[model samples]
Target: MNFTTQRIEDIVVFTLNETKLDANNSGLVKAEFTLLMKLESVKKLIIDLTDVESCDSTGLSALLVANRLVHANDGDVCLVTSSEKVLSLIRITQLNKVLSVFDTLTDALQELKSK
Candidate 1:
């Protein structure tokens, strides 16, 4: 998994630098989320999936894992993506109701900041 992380105050921004988030790499992403949630003690998280053009069920599972982890600690997680396919999948799965979705990193950060 190619990624980078940034911290703004208490929020951690995880930028996944991959064109496809599928079964091939979703496990690593899930592991990283667990590590970030447990070891780093991250409460608020922003998953920047701008580079991810495609996603599979495994990818969505990884996101749910992140959401579960953060919310378990009384925190929140948001996803930022400009891919229409990704957005459609979220809507089709009704994950839009469960996860916060944003069109840009700035938008996600602003919302998370307010919370």
Candidate 2:
């Protein structure tokens, strides 16, 4: 898996260490998220996409699904380091307003904590 997850306080921090977030890596990302959500008190999530190079609708859908899942659990999702291309796609798709995006991990974490 090109993704990894660790806990920091009450948040589940998902770090993407891959160049692509296309279909090939979406499953891995989804599975790791499933595993992380199983843990208790994980009411906040930070997705670090600093290394992600590309994303399709499928990958973006996965993120929305994750966000929905988190919200269902009374939690929220924060996006970190969204590349310019990804950010553009997000804006065009109106997903930028849907997801909580941050330019840095610290900002993401602080946003999560504030919620």
lDDT of candidate 2 at residue 100, scale 0 to 100? 84
What lDDT is obtained when candidate 2 is compared to the true structure?
0.82
**Candidate 2: deviation at residue 104, Å?**
0.8
* Model 2 bad stretches (over 4 Å): none
- Model 2 scores a TM of 0.91
Tell me the TM-score of model 1.
0.98
For residues 11-101, could you state the per-residue lDDT of candidate 2 as single tens digits? Answer: 8888989877879878877776776677655678888998887888878877887888788898889988658988888889988788888
User: Which runs of model 1 end up more than 4 angstroms from their true locations?
Assistant: none
Task: Give model 1 RMSD, 1 decimal.
Answer: 0.6
**What lDDT does the true structure give each of the candidates?**
0.94, 0.82
How far is 30's C-alpha from truth in model 1 (Å)?
0.4
Worst 10 residues of 2 by lDDT: 33-42
C-alpha RMSD of each candidate structure in angstroms? 0.6, 1.3
lDDT of 1 at 62: 96
